[model samples]
Target chain A: MNDPAGAPALSEIAIKPLKHVNGAAHRWVAFIVMVAFFALAPTFIYPVFLMKVMCFALFACAFNLLLGYVGLLSFGHAMFLGIAGYAAAYVAKEGLNIEAIRLGTIHIPLNIALPPFTPELAILTGVLAAAILGYVAGLLAIRRQGIYFAMITLALAQMVYFFCLQAPFTGGEDGIQAVPRGKLFGVIDLSDVKAMYATVFVIFIGGFLVIFRIIHSPFGQVMKAIRENEPRATSLGYDTDRYKLIAFVLSATLAGLAGATNALVFQLAALNAVHWTMSGEVVLMTLVGGLGTVFGPVVGVLAVLGMENYLAQLGAWVTIVQGAIFVICVLTFRRGIVGELARWIKKPL
Target chain B: MTDDYVLETRELTKEFKGFVAVNKVNLKVRRGTIHALIGPNGAGKTTCFNLLTQFLPPTRGRIFYKAKEITGSKPSAIARMGLVRSFQISAVFPHLSVLENVRLALQRKRGGSFDFWRSERILNALDDRARELIASVGLSEFEQTIAVELPYGRKRALEIATTLALDPEVMLLDEPTAGMTHEDVGRISALIRRVAQNRTVLMVEHNLSVVADLCDHITVLARGEILAEGDYATVSRNPEVVQAYMGKGYA
Candidate 1:
């Protein structure tokens, strides 16, 4: 294993697909096609379903930034997702509450309220909150590498899960519901379905573009160099740990971006966004789509969400079906759909 | 602490699990000289090399570069100070392209390693010098190939190219010709001599021919202790050197 950060769970050699891939023009063409597809698809598909996929796609890409580029597999990324969603929802709806944080028999009472914010402000608030949390968590987590890194993140996320369950502002099991979409910049009404769809579309494309830019930038080049050979990077005078932390914080901010937008799309924020299972789902999306490729997660979202949509009638069996499909994906296309395709075409997707 | 020598080690020692890999030894390389550390396997030549670079911490020792104590400095910090080393085993970024490997070596001096917003075209500027380095190492044909995909000797050449890209004040070559063919050894020896004109070079080599041909000073180690230190002619004449090195060289 060349990576000093520690070996990945799936040794890169077994799953390494894209080797002779350099598709600059093809990548741009694909991006344009993606923009067109998403813009036109909602006209035919249900708007909310499209919006959900877009949000999750953004979430998966942000998670992929850490896992794919930096080679840091965070198993606890959902805390960022859920925290931003809760923050956005809380800010969107003005509310008051009196509750006590319980520690066995000990209690600390909390009373809080806030004036409602516009949808954009609420989402920005969510993103800012996630960035701070990510910075703190990144500081603690980067001390360990590889599987230990994953485990530490998982442990920290569990703490967040419990906090959401006990926090006064969170509204407990019910979550903050019916968060008013309000208006975008106090003019474009988010209450309208098309307007909300446009907003989610812009956010997703913007994030996806940012991820693409980072992958190609000078900083991103050094980042890939670190992921490939950390000691060698250090030998060339790079502070690799610092780069890892920055990538972590950026990924967290992007995940928060997705979460905040997703909450607005549904007009609700709940524990589902923050659950460990949500973290698992993002991993699955990144893996099945292509662990490192740019477009992998978007296609991955479509597959996962499509399965859920068609299989919802199966109730509890959905988990079994999703698991079985993941097994097949791991067996058949471990490089993922985009990854294998990139290998075949000799172009980076 | 004299300014004459570019690098000096003060009683450098290392132990692993009660086994002394490198015992207390003092070493110095004068400015603009090729120094050789020639020893048989397990004489701790590589361990000594690692200790000087601080890649492996010395269990009990201190290292100085230009009279400044750098005993506990980070490997990257040591690199930034213009003290650079190549690996005993070729250690280029395996997945990175040949152009990329050399460019990365050229990257650190310019700073802004955190410029995520800038275009990658900024790095393309470094590629010309990277190509020149690659060509000097006779790896121009493998310019686009990943370092791992290159043949073993070619990978070593890539490693050398990256090392040269730094243009360091001091160069440490750990078995530079370890995997190369006869012709490559001559080529690399010439390259080393050319690069060593202005800078200091400290090498750990098993090849007696390279040590005799290029080094200005030779230090022979046996059982992690210096057995001889002088010019090649002087060191070769020592009975201990003949017994320790030549006896094992033939074996």
Candidate 2:
């Protein structure tokens, strides 16, 4: 059948992905099972720790949406993470309330004021702000090639870092501490650790599912096409730059969602989350899991953060251990843990 | 319909610093005719194609497709106007399967190009048309094969099929047979003739035999200017055209 003795008639070709019922059904099953695991995991493990993993997993997945799908690299993605964190914290705690920002010795009393926001609204504000910033930054990053990715990323990173540090509502270097979990949607009291965990879990699962949907969509096909070879895509009438920018913005928005959730969960939005190193950390997480695979980033978050949690007793030796694990993983399963698994299973995941 | 030409260039010129790549060359591709742009190395044949496609903007020129001025149009905009092109290198999306590679072009037929939220399975509606195109190009057997895994000659075939899926009224092929094997060349030449039955073709070709066999009109370029333009017999008989483009072996 593979031999081309004669061409198959127009009606002869059988539809594949659409009709591949087992793969589609199994994928849904896998998703449901994942939801069950996360739902039940808090019973056996610390809710806060799991929340941390979910936040990072969501962030890594968002980053992967750009890096893996569209072949874009955001060197300063931490800007999105940090900016969103600040926005969420600011909205939740102050909501345009310009109290005072302490800079070393000077205290600047600010009069900027707006009504306080609900938790979900605060998160929405962060995500939207991130999306806007991503759009501006993405405008500067060329659609094809990684040469501009580093340049644009660094520029945005510096600008965002300063904004996060100096903004009066952000509490400067101290960040917005003791942010009230507040009532989620004027109903659920997130002060309960389990309730907070559930909210964060919802965010993680939602972001993960969205990213998954985008990748498997027709939009995803074009993104992959651009990634495979952009010139070809351009020739085929695709406004490649627009697609890339949209992908970049979407990636940043999701990352913002993660950061906003993290800020709420810990009741703190620190300057550290917005720092350049945070961006580097997300890249590491995604690479460790699998750069392009769907579950790769989540798996990577599990490995990296889990190792940190489990190896804290070793202190400085943990770095050595972590470095060794990364080295071994790179040498052995270069495609990443989930990437290698996806390959073994012969699935697009 | 006012002009006999489907695609035309008026004084199309491109320069790299002080050196001129394409020097005020006028090109007219008649509708429903196979037009070939033949030239030697560095004769600006590819540059001319690039300018016509707006991939490389000309220093000074005007391009007209279907009698409308398209000088300021973007490469994609021009492509959207039914003037599609193939690259000197095979231009199919390498990681996508042949079916997908073709279906992507067909996706343009249905609107909502940026519908990121919808499932790609909806694109399955286009599989039949994509398969028909694949079969037309003798690639029905490789519909599921990843483009990168295809044999070199077959990759070009896949590209043609992908290009055809765009449903262009005018096709620009930049050395469609570049670096192809002799047998592959013969196969692609016949394929080109077959596909060009209805559409106008403007091609930059190195192979003289293919130009003579398939092209109704030939334009010879050398040192960034048109050396000659006519039927194959007339152009090949020109001593200057032979010396500049065809070489002594052909003469």
Candidate 3:
């Protein structure tokens, strides 16, 4: 076997091993189960609370897309979420109306009026705004690595927070309050709680699937490669920075979608949405759910929100309880709830 | 100006602050030959290798691959031109399976679209060729194992397989047989020889025996400069070469 002088014939080599089956089947099964559970949940539980959970769940998933897959810990993701909330609120309230004029002898009274902005259009505008902001922030933030990257993003997010605080359109302390939920595509009235809950659930599932698809795609494989060994990926002819930037922008846009949906559900976009505390909460949710697992974020958001709802009477003890849970998760189950469950099942959840 | 040489460096130098790691040195690796860059520790063999591979920009000098200047190109850009380098440390994607690693390398060769929306099942087309490469590197059994879970020798083998998947015209291996058992070294040396039949190989190897057996030409560096250059027999016989190794307290 250690024949140094003579080259071994390729024919003598052993047969190639069978490819390992991926966890795709398990993931899809889990997704179906979760969707079914949610569909039935509103019948028993409060629809509004469930919608809130779905919103945060989507946010956590978006944040995990970068943290788990790309190995980037963005400490300012709330900026995207908050900014998108503001954008959606503003658009839904103001109704995006563009004036059209014909220059000539006669001016026709034809105004391109798109008044009474729909929920779908507002959400799209919010996502677009988030994408544009992500591009600008990601460009500056990706210049650093590890802690410095975190700090840079945090600093950028703080600047945005202050801008929101001072900006007239944001309404400063009060925020853009009482935003109209409006209609979905100018037909379905979102004012109805059931309709609103259904819309949010659909948005959450759609965003979740997109993230899942991204994680399983070729681009995702390369992103994982970059995460594992960036220099190796670079040597393999991948522009690592470009891939990272793309992941970052995508994560931000999804977070924005979650934020927009949250605004529509609550009928308000406020300072709490854009605050650094919200960013930390998303991280905590993702961590508790499992960093890389597909369904981990959903479970994590549910647990956290469930505790908050149940422990409202406990006052400061809620924070202490959250801290205790985080510590326990880190020490006993470092992989988070879904991660540990996935490990037990011997499948990638 | 000659096309016979696949890679050439002119006055390649790298300085970290005031201390020069790689002094101004010219290296010419002829096409389709196993060229070894051998030297004692701190001889700047790795530094020179890094310079040529675009891992580190040269403080001063120019690099030419196939007579085209690629002095300040990015590592990936250089790799696209069929000049790829393997890391001294096994640089395989740790979490990915061996087959997946090879497929990833092959995907780079294909230069496919950056469509993140498409299913990864599309990459299955490269499986047949990836399996061939794995078998060639004697890693057929470990094709489905995560790269990080493989034993040391197998990890190195997987790294080689991944590198080979690139179909590089000129391959640069940094200490390809470093930290290997005697048997692993022998097998890899033979593998390197087989692989170099059509492609040029520029390697920084510490195992002189492997170099003597596989390399067609050798460049000996000492104190960040070329001490001797020739075939192994010629360079090994040179008193200066012996003295440099002996000065480093090696017999």
Candidate 4:
């Protein structure tokens, strides 16, 4: 039997239909709430610690972009963090106000052009570098999926750690210290910690917004399709690999944004920035916060960073605690804090 | 009418090591006919389907759809050309709601595929298309159900409905009635007939009765070679077809 020629359209029904699997009003409300918290946080907490929290929160958020949205678990995100940190630190501290005067067949100026590099320039460089590295790393990591993908990232991160340790530009084990925060457009004094904190907050929020937009977009649908079934996505005429690679680069660029901010905020870029442990830390943050939810990483970063602030004197006990939390998350809290709460509320967090 | 034949394979051959899975196969499917490819197990039915759809590249020959050669084309490219193949088993987004799964496919079908900013509108629009597809496939009652949560027969029906969301000119279904109960089979058979009214359908089925009842023509394949080809009555009585099914003719 043929379908009726003129029927009431499927669009004109009782229910308007859920436009998105994740609710729009809920997400918008969440964004407003997050902005309110970010605005009020400085008044209640120490500015430096709050700044540090903001930096790590941004870092964790960037890390979550790959793991949560794309369903890719990365273990070497620290490469982007560390590389960008060192690069920004080096540019701010030594490279910015250098001289080029003639010295024994080498023309180096005595008074270098003091056109001080802006924060925007530093962050842009950081994003570009991270995207490039991510392109290369993702090409290799995406060749294998699931647990194998994690292992490949972990191994590559170890290689980066060793490279940073041996490379003289990175200052070997000492790293580049006394990194100047530099000007916010060659005008604002970044030494004013409040201004710096505001700057970091803006970058973090901007990066977060871009990520939110992406995950909610049509491009994001392809990613979910790839995550669910790559073969079927391919059969549906989607270039799945390119989508994965783009996701990887986007995640890395945001991670680099966090790294550049970290370098500026602390006035130092250390070997610890690139270490495998740092990579593991971000994974722990995402896991404890929520693996797939939007605001999960922020919660995760705040929790982990808060613990670190109090337990800094506990030495290796912090590592032990972090490991325990990871185990707990894997075995008991597969949904993480936010994920479980969302389930209880019967709404997406 | 030249463009109406949605799928055509010319001397398509697939060889794995020394074994030929599909050999010198030429297939022509009209734009809106439920073309059934019925054969015994291992008659290269699956392989031929795969080759025509470019799941596996043919060692020899080419495939054309809508007057365009599709040899060596990627599966996604072929699908984008309005030809989509559903696996024998159910293929669906299990974690997503039935409406969401269909909407995703509809989003892909529309040119608004890359627009992340406007997905909300597109997905909203797709619900109507999804509902129509669901109703067409006799799944209107379960429109909001999760695909994986559905019963086995229902899941298969959902898979077909999901494929329809692509608005394909030609649909390749491998064993659309496999492992189905008698009632379920009859329902699916009717649905298939309805869908085939306006779209080309190429399916492989072991259920001979379903073939006899639904198919416009029959192609019998034995050991990767065409054994018989004609209407159901002619092919069913062909000596080679009887020999392949029964193992030997009775004296």
Docking class of 1: acceptable
Q: Tell me the TM-score of model 2.
A: 0.92
**Model 3 TM-score?**
0.93
A197: Cα error in model 2, Å: 1.0
**iRMS values in order, in angstroms?**
4.0, 5.4, 6.5, 5.8
The pairs that clash in candidate 1 are none
Provide candidate 1's TM-score on chain A: 0.89
> Alpha carbon lDDT of residue A311, candidate 2?
88
TM-score of chain A of each: 0.89, 0.88, 0.89, 0.87
lDDT of 4 by residue, A76-195 (tens): 999999888877777776665556766789885667554435766876766677778888999999988878888999898888888888986789878988877888888898999888
Candidate 4: list runs displaced more than 4 Å: A1-33, A43-46, A96-116, A151-159, A166-168, B1-6, B17-19, B109-112, B117-119, B242-251
Ranking by lDDT: 3, 1, 2, 4
- Candidate lDDT scores, in order, read 0.86, 0.84, 0.86, 0.78
For the second chain of model 3, what is the TM-score against the true structure's chain B?
A: 0.96
DockQ of 3: 0.48
DockQ of each: 0.47, 0.51, 0.48, 0.38
Instruction: Give me the displacement of residue B139 in model 4, in angstroms.
Output: 3.2
- Steric collisions counted per model: 0, 0, 0, 7
